[model samples]
Structure formats: structure tokens, C-alpha cells
Target: MSIKSVPLPDIGNFKDLPVIEVLVAAGDTVEAEQSLITLESDKATMEIPAPFAGTIQKVLLKVGDTVNVGDLIVEMSTQDNEATQKPAESAPAPAAAPTPPPVVDAPARSTTAEPASPPIPPTPPSTAAPVNAPTLGASAHASPSVRAFARTLGVDLSQIAGSGPKGRIQKSDVTAFVKQALTAPAHSAPATGGSIPPLPTIDFSQFGAIETIPLSRIQKRSGKHLSTCWLNIPHVTQFDETDITELEAFRQSLKARADKMGVKLTPLVFILKAVARALADFPRFNAALDASGENLILKKYIHIGVAVDTPNGLVVPVVQNVDQKGIFALAADLAALSARARDGKLTPEDMSGGCFSISSLGGIGGTQFTPIVNGPEVAILGVSRSKMSPVWNGSAFEPRLMLPLALSYDHRVIDGAEGARFITALSRSLADLRELIV
Candidate 1:
């Protein structure tokens, strides 16, 4: 009996250390170094490596479990082939479909040879499975939320394919299935009574002249959390605008490589990079709150949040260890997170935890707006719109693109003067863009 151990690899981000899914189960056959389990840290997902050639004899962890470096993920039996079930071999080819007796309208046949690879064998279905009686109108097993999602998209999971845990329908899987069913050939009817519930009509009589639409699930939660942060934490505000000609030019120079990496080298992403850089010297800015009422809270890691505006609402997704990642990699992650935000797909975990926040409308070149500090974060940097404007060039006005930056900080933890100075440092960092790449 040869026993092989599966050790967890050093996944890059700490946030992703939570094990989301374990791919292989006991008695399951996995190739050497195949993905054994999946762990998500820092919103980035990575897979654990199989330690050796083996049969998975045991799985030590489950989903939502947290793990660390050098932890034992699983154990496997690395016995020789003869000691275990014989490896399945590719099957031989079936004879080409014989041409029907040549009809008058039959097309001509070619003499080309088929590939020599052997045919595959039919897979045996799982042995231990329960057979349930099918329901008529709809499945009672599905949750109300899942059913509502399916109804919203006009999806019938019975006709559409299911790509979810244990084949249970997921929201995304349902949405994709609906899209496929739309383009599919002559459709089959789903269990009858499948329809979208109508939206409730609004009643305006209860409120005064002005009434705002209620927030979404994500927005409502964000509002409550940020409100608590506002009440307990004393916040100070400071505003500054910088002429970022050099930063704008430098970003343009890296456009090709940035695009290839799927990184959007926006002035905002640059500002984030600088904020992280500056925090290295100013430990006071990179900290958390201790509303526990005894002592102030400080963090050892410098995670920064880049606030993203989506259809659902504003979400500030943190980029963990901003100082560790290069500008290009951070830019790529920013793009990926923005896509997640716009889709309203970010999980609760995505919106939590950050040392600092940066919000920017500079992509559209708007004047300036104060960005509320994401709760628990000490500072939020607001980036204004960048545009070609007149700047004094040796007494002559020259038209050049300049980015306006607005800096907002918590007054309780950070001083007004210090906040202004921090923004000043950020502006110099942006104007002196050379420091970023190195």
C-alpha cells in the first residue's frame, strides 16, 4: 500500500484561502497533479495540486472551509495499476455508416480514410442513486429565490441543461439555459404553469411629494453597513485637484500591453496603485476601526478597494495586498472585478473588508464629487473626469488632458491637514508617474 499526501499550494491571495469546492471525492481516480480542490482567495480562484499519482482515498475538507499553507488537503493511494482497477482504454471505431443502396437523388461518396484513434467506451452511470417520482406542474425541491430567478428569465430547467452543484439549478445556470432554449430547435413544453410573476404596482399616497425607489438586496445591505460606519467613525474631508499630464501620457504609452492583459490602465487604477504605495510610508492611513470601544483597530495587510458603479448600486471591491501586485496584474484584476460588479454577480464576500477606497468618475471627465468612505476604511479617493484643458506652458496656454482628483478621509482617525498632505503626495505620485512602473 503506497500512501501519497496532497499538500496545499501557496495560493497568491489570502482572501481566496477559503475552500469553495473540493473536486475529487474518496474512491475517485485523479491523474498526478490534477486539480484536487478549488480555493478562492482575494476574489481570485485557484486550484490545489494533486501531490502524486493516486486514487483519492479521502477528502479532508469541505466547501466554505478555510485552509493555510502546508495544510494537508487530502490523502491518496498511489498503488501500481495492477493493484487497482485496470485503466480504461479508448474503444475501437465503429464501421462507417454504410451508404444506403444508391438512390437516384443520393449524393456522391468520397474514398477518404477516417482517423485511426480507438473509439471510447460508454461510461457506467453512478451505482448508488435514488429515483424520485417526477412532479407535474413544477419542482417542489427548488427554493423560492431560485424559482423566482428561473421565472424572471422564462427558463424551464426540465428542458434546459443544469450546470450547478449536484445538478441543482443555479441562477447563472438558469439564465444560460434560458438563452440556449431561446435559440434551440422546436421546443418541448416545460411543466405547465411556468410564468413570470408580475411586478407590484406602486402606491404613492403613503409618502410626501418625494419618494425614492427602495434599494436592491446589495444596495440595502451596503447602505446599512456604511451608515453604521458613518455614525461611529469621525470623518474629515479634504479636496484637491491635480494636473496629471505626465500620468495621462504614461498610461497611453502602456495601452497595448494593458489591453492584452485585460487591464484598464485608468487614472483610477493608477490612483489606487499610488495610494497603496503611499500607505507603505504612512501606516496611519492603512488601518481598520475598533468599534468594540476599547482600542483602535489596525491591519497588517494593505488592501485597497476600488469602488465600482453597477446597475444594482455602488460596490467597493478590495484588491488585497495592492503593494504586492504589479500595475498590470492589478489592472487586470480591476477589469475582472468591474465585470463582476456590472453583472450584479458579486457575492457578499466581494464587498467586505478594505483598508482604503478609491472612487472615480474621471473616466467620463466630470468635475468633482465627494466619495463616501466605504465603512471600516479610513479614506476614499474620488477621481474626477480627465479632459484636454488649457494649462500654462511658459506663459502660453497649451491644451492638454488633466485629471482632477478629490481626496476624502475619515476625520476621526486622520487629521484634515494630514488628509490634504496625503492627497498632495498622491498628486505628486501621479504627476511623477515614473515611480509607478518601477
Candidate 2:
């Protein structure tokens, strides 16, 4: 039998990461790559895996302890199968190998009933778990990837009953958990006597014959997300009009060239380019409120999401590095992504990491509508159909193509004045090709 010490591996650039949960205990057998403990960093929740198959002689770590690389986590006893065949009969266990004392072992420190960082209280399985769930010492049968997924959806593992082999939780379980949480009926508040009134649930069936059709999966998912963003964010929409008379002429001139390239150039594509340029000029509009809400995360690269109306529901597929691409390139990418989105072939990555989003209802004939700012991203641009209207250009009224633009932003990050300025910049970029190029 060989006594081996398992040490923590290097985990990114973070230091003094708090141990959120201790999975294994003394005298328990574990396999290589099995998670032994979980760590919570500022950016993400991570797990430390077992080094090798062995029986734990002593666990050196506990929840709430701050750990770093090279710190001993556990002491284990490993024995080869060949050695086990004759070990007990001939060598009588070989007098367990002498264990070396670790300089900073978890067990050596004084034990506390409470963890250094207290775990979040157990939310009723009815509600979604907090994004940062406390590391409860309770054992949860799940993989590291599944745990991460649960955290992303703000799910608590202890509350879910596993459906996999040996009752292991899977990604599907997390999805089902969220769906169940969202679809569940609203529970009445506890009788604490608060002044606020609750909306009375009226039985509409008594008034008339009605059919209840459940929301589509996309609608349900998007509804929960939108509700969260709307409730949490202080939103303000600024409406304006952009004169695209010259830009329209410029686009028409390139119609033949666009057809030659097998791409149908639409005003939306030009609008995408104009918006990308606007983001570059007004950098703050290309930012998101950090998770802490204390800092702004300004993105250097512009990836804009275009909302595509599908048979099922609306989906937004992101076009990456919009600033680097030309108008034609943007048109091609937009066409491909929008087609994929409509066909339901868009992948998860296709709709993620958008610095900003554009929801255009021009083809559908809407004058202007306020768009909800996609959470994390501070703002969204709404585009309506362009109409020819008389405009006074210095001397006389002349027919000009005018496009209505609505900018909805999180008021916490953007002031009303800044929102107006951003829309003004966008209008300028769309009004002239020179502004876009410059």
C-alpha cells in the first residue's frame, strides 16, 4: 500500500478561492477524475477532481476554507491489484506507508461548525436557485459540467432528484427543473401582513369557453428571461427618425452587384453596418452592466444579434466582428444567420455573446415598438419600415426616406442624454456613407 497526498491543481489567476463544498470524506473510496471538492471563484464555480483511485485515509479540506495551488486536499491509500493478491496473506497490509505531514493541511486547522463562507439558504425547489448557490457540504450526484449548467440556470442540485444512473443529475434534468419552476403556479405570500396587494386570480372559464394552450418551449424560455430583465433593469426607450434618402440611393446602386454575389441586399443589412459603425463611435452603447452592477464591460469587438421571426417563435443569431466586415460581408452573414435561425438550425453559440442586438420590424409594417434590452447587454436597437415623407432641407419641403429608430437601454448604465446622443450618432451614420466609413 502506498500513501499518496492529493494536492490542489492551479486554477486560473484567482487566489484564496473559497472551498464551497467537500464531496468525499475520510474512509471513502474514490476513482480518478471524480470530483473531490468544489471551489467558488469570482468568475465561476469549479470543481477539484480526484487524482487517482484510492481509499481516503484523511480529508484535508472542508467547505469554507480558502485554498490555493499545491495545497494538500486529501491523503489516500492506493494498492495494486497484483499486490492485493498476496498482500494480506504474506505481508499483512505492509504496515500502512508512513504518511508525510503537509505544511498547510486542511485537517490540521481547527474545525468550525460553520463554513468560512456560509452557503446560500436552501431555496424551495419551487424557485430557481440563485446564480451563486452556497457550497453546502451535502453530497450531490452530478458531474462538474452538470453542476456548471445548474449554476448557469440558478438551480440548486440538492433540490433536484436525479434521473440518471445511480440517481445522477444531467443537463436535461436542469432544463426540466427550470421549466417546472417557471410553469408552476404563483404561490400566495406568507401571512406576514404586507401593505402591497396581490393580483386576484379570476377564473375566466366561468365567463366564457376558453382553451389553454401551453407556450412553446422557445416562448417559455424567452418569456422567463425577458421577465427577469424587465423586472431588474431600469429601462428607457428613446425614439428618433433617420433620413436615409442618400443611403437608399447608395443601396439601390449596389443591388445589381449584390445579385451577382448571390446575396439580396436589404436595408436591414445596411442598417446592420450602420449600427456597427455607431457602436464603434459610441463605445458605451456596446457595453453591458457587470454581474456586480458596479462596473461596465465595454466590448472591443462588435457582435450584433439580428432578431429572426420563425414559425415557432423569435430567435436572434449573432453576427461576429461586425466592425471588421464590409457591407457585402455583413449582408451575406446576416442572410445565413437569419435563414438558420428561421430554420431552427441555429446552435447555442449562434445566439450567445452579443454585444448588442437589433430587432427590425420593417418587413412586418410596424412604425415603432420598444424592444427589451437583452440582459447583460445594456441596449437594443429597434428598426421600423422606412417611409417617404416630406422634409424641409434648408429651403423647401422634399420627399425623403425616413426610418424610425427606437433605442431601449438600461437606465442604470445609460442616461437619457447619452441614449439620445447614441441614437443621433446612429442616425448620422445611416444618413451618410461617409460617416460610416470614417
Candidate 3:
């Protein structure tokens, strides 16, 4: 038998992942593709698997040790095919044929092209078997991606109820869990104040009969997410009103063309285009804070999410590649996505990957309102009812269509000055269509 070393596989851009668990000990027999150790990063957890079957000669890593791709994991004593063949020399030539099958079967079982590699198990020995954490008391039924996401947030998967296939945990499940944790009310008192007493639970039944209607699933989920955004993010709302008098006239001019294209182009479409341009001018608004909270992830592609109000709750369907698509294309996408959202037909994919969000209450009656910043996204635009207001044009005062704009952004990522600049740029785009065209 000969000894062979197993090194960690490529984990992609992640450096210095800390070892969370060691599955095998020295002298323990392990099979090929079996998990040997688990590494956890800020965003996800991953496992190092055995390359080939062998008895572990030396376990090079332990829990809490930091590791990276290509780092040595274990020294394993594997069967030497040449040494095994030495015994075949004394036997008949026919024995050599059977010996080749074991060697062939060994490689075939361990290294199949399909499932090309082993599942990168992302838990330590205490939670061995990524699919089933027997040691953890109850199994967390979740997809690999969901598992990694849960670990990234340091959530206990066993505590969350799955709302997916066969009760499998989904990405939304992990997100919901984190949001709940962030928003869940604190039972403790304030650090500066004395212990505050809890509010008394009222029993209204003593006076009159009351009926309880539970909130819809969507409402409950959204409420938690909104609460998280409100408490965790330091939001600064930059309020400004844009003069859309000329822009509205231009949009009306295209009414016939828009109708011929089988789409109704509304003011929101023009606003979408303006937001995309502003994002291009200010790339920080198009970025998100990484899981570590130390790095910024600036997205090159611009996808905007439009908040739609449904009977069930609020849903944000994303319009992809806003920077690349024209107003007409955006009109079509918005029409399709909003209709689907209202009909409760919007899939999970329809609501993912939004660099920015817009919540417009213009159709209803609202002068101004604050909208929470969507998690993972740094900013959101709130649009309210437009009204005719007198504006001074340097020479005289004239009635102009003024649209209320509330720009809420993460104070950590954006400063008050940058916020002012973003809103100013957006206001300019609306005031002068030529600037947007240029």
C-alpha cells in the first residue's frame, strides 16, 4: 500500500474559510467521495471530500482552523495496484483478468463523470451528513443552496418550517428566518433605561365577542421583512419633487405609437428609465453590502423591482436588464409582471435579483410615504401622487406637474450628499427628456 495526500478543491473566490468540523480521525477507514472536513465562510459553508478510499494516515486539520482551496486535508494510505499485482505473478494469466476488474470498478464507482464531483458537504462531524444531520437530533430538509444560505446567516435550520417540495427548506425560508430574527421584539429592557414592564394582555371577550382572522402568509412574511429593514438599516429619506410637465407631454405624444405596439406606456415607464439612468450615474445605489458587511457587491447588470399590491399582500416582481431594455420593452415587462403579481402567478424567480426597488403609490392617493429598503438591496424609490404646483422659471411662476419622490437608502452605503445628488439627477431626467436621451 502507498500513501496519498488529499487537497481541498477550488471553492471560488472565498479565501480562508474556517474549519467547522472534522469528520474523520487518523486511522479511520474512509470511502472515496466521503466528507472529511467542513469549512464555513461568511456567506456559505462547504465540505472537503475524500478523493479516494483509504485508511486515514494523518488528519491535518481540525475544527476552528482556517483553510483555503488546495490546502492539504489528509494523508491517506491507499491500496497500491502494482503491489497487489505482485501476487498475480505466481497465479495463472486468467487471474490477471479478474484483478483488472477491481481496479476498473474502483475508479468507476468513485469518479463517475455525471455527478462529476461529490456533494460538497458543509457541516462539521457534530452535524455530519449534509443531507441528514443525525447527530443534531432532527434532520434539516433543505436543498444544498438553502443549507449554505442558512449557515451563512448562522441560522438553526431545524427551527424553521419548510414551505417547499416535500417540506424542503428554500432560499426564501432562510431569508424569512433571518428577517424574523432581526425583527422579533426584544424581551429585555433598554441598555440605558431600567427594566420596562411588559404591556398587559387584554381579554376583550369580557365585554364583547371578538373574531380572530389570521393574516395571510404573504402579509406575515412581508411584515417580518419590512420590520427587519426598518430596524437594521439606518434609512435616510431624501424627499424631492420633480417637474414632469414636459415629460408627460412627450409621453402623451407617444400614445398612438405605444398603442400600436400593443402596450400602454405610462408615467411609471418613463420613471423606470430615469431610475436606471440615475443608477448608472451613481453605481453605489446599484450595489449591496456583502454578507461580511465589510465589502460591497456592485452589480453590472441593472434589474429593478416594482412593488405591486395584491389582495393577498405586496409582491415585487423584477424587470431584468433595465439598462439594456428600452421604454417600450420595459412597458411590456412591467405589464406582464404586474398582472402576474396581482393574479398571484408570480414565481420566485420573478421576484429575485433586484439591484433596486420602486414602490409607487401614485395610482392611489398619497403625497409622500417612506418605503423600507429591500434587504440585500441598498436603496428604494417611493413615488406618490403628482399634483399641479406653481414653479418659478426664473422669469415668472408657472403651473408644473410636480411628482413626489422619496428616496430611501442605507446610510452606511450612501451619504446625505450622495443621496441629494442621486435625487437631483433623477429630477433632472424627469424635468428634461433631452437629458435622458443624451
252-349 per-residue lDDT for model 1 (tens digits) = 99999888876678766777778887787677788855645345577778888777776656666667788898788887778877777676445434
lDDT of 3 by residue, 141-221 (tens): 654445555555556566677787666666676666666655555544332111212245599899999998998645654
Runs in model 2 deviating more than 4 A are 1-199
Evaluated at residue 60, the lDDT of candidate 3 is: 90
TM-score on alpha carbons, each prediction: 0.52, 0.59, 0.58
Writing each residue's lDDT as its tens digit, candidate 2 over 1-438 gives 888787777554446655767889999998766778876542223566775688889999877676777788888888855122111121100101110000111111222232122222222333433322222202356655566556555465766788977777766776666667655666664322111233455899999999988875456446545655666678999999999999989889999999999998999888888888888878888997776779988899999988888766776778999888888898899888777666555543566668889999999897999999877788999999999999997999999999999999989888999999989988988888798766
Model 2 TM-score relative to the real fold? 0.59
- The per-prediction tally of clashing pairs is 12, 1, 0
> Model 3 scores what on Cα lDDT?
0.70
For model 1, the superposed segments whose C-alpha errors exceed 4 Å read 1-214, 292-294, 436-438
Model 3 residue 248 CA deviation in Å: 0.5
lDDT (CA) per prediction: 0.59, 0.69, 0.70
- Most TM-score-accurate candidate: 2
TM-score ranking from best candidate downward: 2, 3, 1
